[model samples]
Target: MSPLDQLFSNYLPVFLGTGIGAILVISALVGSRLLAPYSEERNKGTTYECGMLPIRRASTNVGMRFYLYAILFIVFDVEAVFIFPWALSYLAVGPQAYWEMVVFVGILAVGLAYAWKKGALRWQ
Candidate 1:
């Protein structure tokens, strides 16, 4: 077989995956358009969350600290999660990986320091 044919054969799974994804998406959209509910009125359109009516207007001011703590939690939480795999791979990959993790942690520490200096952690 030619090089192009060989390449495609080697990557057939990838192309099949993409084609399958496209087919599924198109089928879902078409199926929904044909069979889904078409109500566009007052009761069917109103927003609801946690089985409660959304009372707060989106433009109203809310606490910034709520979001700050959420963001901080996600950042460190993600960092903590990533460190485990890095720690596990340390022996197989040797000290270079450890140093790379040190650098990664250092950068994260710098960002955290900057945030701390700016009082993002404060409950005010």
Candidate 2:
């Protein structure tokens, strides 16, 4: 086969799949827009909370500590995720991988220590 034919053959499925996926997404969006209910009442756009009438502005002051805790949680959660795959493949990948993971964990521990020292881990 010619190079052009070979290239077309290799990428035909990818192009077809992308076109199909796009069509599906566009159809779903159009269907929803056409079939979903629409209302223009003032109450329809108001802030809703637990089926109760909102007494105050919806936006409120959130403490910086909440963000700090969330970031720390995400960091440690991702570390655990990485550790699981490494743990499963440790023996096959040998001592180099083990030492690499040890170094990774050591870095995370140092970060945790630093955060502790800076009072980022304090609850109150």
Candidate 3:
């Protein structure tokens, strides 16, 4: 068989599944919009927050600390993702894999310690 045909045959189930999923999602969305009731009540269109009408524009300045905390969380979260696969196969891969993970985690630990010392974890 040709390589092109062989490749498609191998991935036929994946392609069919993806196409079916896309169709199902699109149909559900279109069906909901078509079948759902349309209403034009006066209060229904207004934004409600904490059962109180909004007095001003919703846009507000966020603190820089919030972004710093978020970035730190993302960095550590990605580190943990790499560690998971290494841990699952650590036994078969032996000491070299174990030491590699240790160095990876140790570097992160140092960074965490630095952040702690700098008061990044503190919320005020």
Candidate 4:
């Protein structure tokens, strides 16, 4: 009947669930260590890198064009994603939402234009 009792009842489930999950995870990990193979090779030169040569110094200026294009692609891809949700709800959301999208897209267009002007797109 009391506010304190109601709040405690609501929060008690979350606290109990978290404590149970933690205990189970710790027990499973300890059990696994006992049952699993343990290896200690201090020199780990063969750490996974897509089966490429384990020793190679990368030249820093190999090609920034890839990174540049990736960034631009993500930027416009995000713009398209935003447009989709807005377009889907446009009829239900009315013209105010549409106007908001126009403002959002205008900002994106300006940014893309600035990048273009700054020669970020030039691969040379």
Q: What C-alpha lDDT do the candidate models reach, one value each?
A: 0.89, 0.93, 0.91, 0.86
Kindly list the per-residue Cα lDDT of model 1 for residues 22-123, writing each as its tens digit: 999999999999999787687766676767778867678879899998898899899999998887779899989989899999999998999999999778
Q: What lDDT tens digits, residue by residue, belong to model 4 across residues 79-121?
A: 9998887778998989999899889989988988998999997
lDDT-superior candidate, 2 or 4: 2
lDDT of 3: 0.91
Off by over 4 Å in 3: 1-38, 50-52
Residue pairs of candidate 1 with colliding backbone atoms: none
Ranking by TM-score: 3, 2, 4, 1
lDDT of 1 at 104: 91
Model 3 TM-score, 2 decimals: 0.62
lDDT of 2 by residue, 1-124 (tens): 9999999999999999999999999999999999998878987887768888888885798989999999999999999999999989999989999999999999999999999999998988
Clash list (residue pairs), candidate 2: none
Q: What lDDT is reached at residue 25 by model 2?
A: 100
Runs with alpha carbons beyond 4 Å of true place in candidate 1: 1-62
TM-score for each of the candidates: 0.49, 0.54, 0.62, 0.49
Displacement of the residue 77 alpha carbon in candidate 4, Å: 1.1
For the record, the alpha-carbon RMSD of candidate 4 to the native fold, in angstroms, is: 7.2
Per-residue lDDT value at 97 in model 2: 98
Instruction: Report the backbone clash tally of model 3.
Output: 0
Using TM-score as the measure, name the better of candidate 2 and candidate 3. 3
Query: How many clashing pairs per prediction, in order?
Result: 0, 0, 0, 0
Error of 3 at 41 (Å): 2.8
